[model samples]
Target: MKSAAKATPAEDSAETSTQLIRDSIRVAIVERRLSPGTKLSENDVGNLFNVSRTLARAALQALSYEGLVSVAKNRGAFVAYPSPDEARQIFAARRLVEPGILREAAARITPDDISQLKQLLLEEGRLMSERGQTARRAEIKASGDFHLRLAEISGNAIMQRFMEELVARSSLVIALYGQSTVSSCGHSEHGDIIAAIEGDDLDRACRLMLHHIAHIEADLDLRERKSLGLKEAFEL
Candidate 1:
């Protein structure tokens, strides 16, 4: 079967509509564009990206699979509002998954992977250095790209898919309960992880990955949700 994914053109060619939908929502969540409980209407998303509702459904379903959004029987879809316990579980899962990926990558990461990872870091650092913690396109792009790059090194498509999903959900959790919008995910830890991996210290690389995820969990305020309108903004 052909995958639900279909490639696009130039800038769009690199990402399919489903991936686009997944990423758009992910960005909105990470950058505080969509807060917890934000309603996502199908028609809205279809219009924003100029796609059919069919494609939008695919995107939303992909996110639901990742636990970033909830699609109710009759209520349509809304951003996930993870309970504190659920939040803890998410981080715990990340601690295991990410560290394993780091350790495996350290064992087999190629020079090209290192080069790409470094390039990605440069983009991430640039995003963080911007004047404001703006939800600029580049910032969102970098956030997702970081996970994609790591998954590339991990060399397992299924688990890598899980990481991508987890990363998206992590963004949702951050948007909802984040303590400060300044830095939802630490901007510098990737380099530390890379350095450890490059030095062939698998233990240290694993530790660094664990610590990085812990820092993200620490950023969550866990109090309650705020109102950001990805739904209303793009009508999606």
Candidate 2:
């Protein structure tokens, strides 16, 4: 067989730069460092990442496709500011999709899967117990990751993709509408779901998953939007 073509240095550099910009923005948004409706200037992103405007633009375009960024004529790009109606729709979609995901995961999850999940929970508990901005950010990410991990265990590619999008949008919803008093996902509830899955109790797993999601949605202050600052909005 002929040798496979290799990426040139320029191509590799461009790809790396694009991914760096994309991932930085994505993590910033997901971690709530970048708030909704914050303007993303192409120049600023290029400067921040030390890449060309073209690469920064490409990164923002990718995020736009992921529904985490909005691009408008003359407005450049901004972190998405999802409305109350959109929030309801996102949760509604989750309600339909996640129960099925849990059902499959419960049936197929191996002992190793249970072990891995327990480890993740252990780490989550430690992070939640810690104090400071860094710990809180890690906790939030780990909280969402639990559901994403379940989606992976389900062995459904489409459901996995859907869960990825839903979880990302859920971060945006929490940023916009979530109340400070309510935690994202309770550690105890996660433990209960994991126990049910380990026992192959499909119905119980599904029920617990639905209840978990509903608890998160119920914590949102969806009646009004929170005001955000420009500097705090687009820190990256």
Candidate 3:
């Protein structure tokens, strides 16, 4: 196999900085530290990271494209607040995509992959059991990461990228419409899907995956939009 190409020092540094900024904001959003519709000023981000406005702008632009942030002409950026209709559409798209991914993963997954997934599930369970704002936030992020890991195991780079975007958008949807106490995707349900995959039961895995997605979508209280504010948004 051919070796992967290495980035030059300057390129690596730039990529690392961009990724750091992106991840910081993404994690904040996933943890609900940044609430939906909260304005994200470039200067605020730059100050938070001790980075340049240009880098902050690039990070915000990237997030906007991921559907986690919305940008308006001269209005600056804000965390995306998915409408009920948009929330429905996001879940509908996930239903279309995730089952097939699980099926493929079931067929192709190795023993090590299953082990890793079990470990993640364990960690998720641990986080869920802990009581605190930090534990709750970690659990939320872990729940979304589970689906992203499934996509990664499907061994499709394109699908992996698609799921990454979908999961991020789903975070926004959950922030806006999900009931406060309901787990985004229940840890038990995730375990069931993983069990099916481990057994190499493609049909069962796909079915469980669909059910899992539906269950999450069903938990949403989409009748009314959640109110937003910068104070709630910026708190970590």
Candidate 4:
């Protein structure tokens, strides 16, 4: 068989830059630094990242496919501002799938997996006590990682992918409508879920997981907003 042709140097550079811009923006959104409905004009994004507008548009388009950004016909891109119904639907999706995910994870979970999960919980707790945007962001990501990790342990590739998207989109929902700064399930509840898993109580684990998702959904205020600025959201 012939070896595949490699990307040209310029193509490689553009691809790497596009990925970096996309990831940076995704992280900002997940960390709540970027608010829902914040405009992400190609020109502004290009200027902020020091890339061409084409690259900026590419990045935004990537995010749109992830359900994190919304691109308009003539307007441009904005962080997705999930409505109350949309937020409800997101949580419903979680509620429907997480129990099954948890069950699968429980069936396959190893002691090492439990240790890693506990470590994530510990790191999340530490970040909760720390004061700063960085700490808060880490805490939020770690919180989501708890669920993502569980999905990983489940050994289901499709469910893992779904969980990733669900978690990312959930970040957007919580950023827009959450009453508290805390996102995802509560910190203690994570420990409880882990304990249930470790104890081989899959039934209890599933129950805790459902409660955890419900708790997150209950914290949403789900109201409309007037305006948002992308420059401020990016802190650029």
Query: Which candidate has the highest lDDT of all?
Result: 4
Q: In angstroms, how far off is 155's CA in candidate 4?
A: 2.0
lDDT of each: 0.73, 0.85, 0.84, 0.87
Model 3: how far is 91 from its true place, Å? 0.5
2 or 4, which is superior by lDDT? 4
Q: Is candidate 2 or candidate 3 better by lDDT?
A: 2
Question: Which stretches of model 4 miss by more than 4 angstroms?
Answer: 1-15, 223-236
TM-score of 3: 0.87
Residue 109's lDDT within candidate 3 is: 78
lDDT of model 1, residue 159:
73
Candidate 3 has an lDDT of 0.84
> What is the RMSD, in Å, between candidate 3 and the native fold over all Cα?
5.7
Model 4 scores a TM of 0.85
Tens digit of per-residue lDDT, candidate 3, span 49-135:
999999999999999988889999899999998889899999999999998888776767778778988999999999988998889
Among the numbered candidates, top TM-score falls to: 3
Per-model RMSD to reference: 7.4, 7.0, 5.7, 7.5
Task: Order the candidate numbers by lDDT, best to worst.
Answer: 4, 2, 3, 1
What would the per-residue lDDT of candidate 4 be over residues 1-236, giving only the tens digit for each residue?
Answer: 14421211124344488899999998889888999989999999999999999999999999999899999989999999888888889999999999999998888888888998999999999998998888888999999989999888888877887888899999988887889756546999999999998888899989998999999988988765534466656775
Cand. 4 Cα-lDDT: 0.87
lDDT by residue (tens digit), candidate 2, 1-236: 14521211124344476877888898898888999999999999999988889999999999998899999988799999999989999999999999988888777787877898899999999998898888888888989889888888887767886787889889999888888643557788999999887777778888998998888899887885445567767886
List of clashing residue pairs for candidate 4: none
Worst 10 residues of 1 by lDDT: 1-10
Clash pairs, model 2 backbone: none
- My TM-score estimates for the predictions, one after another, are 0.77, 0.86, 0.87, 0.85
* TM-score ranking, best first: 3, 2, 4, 1
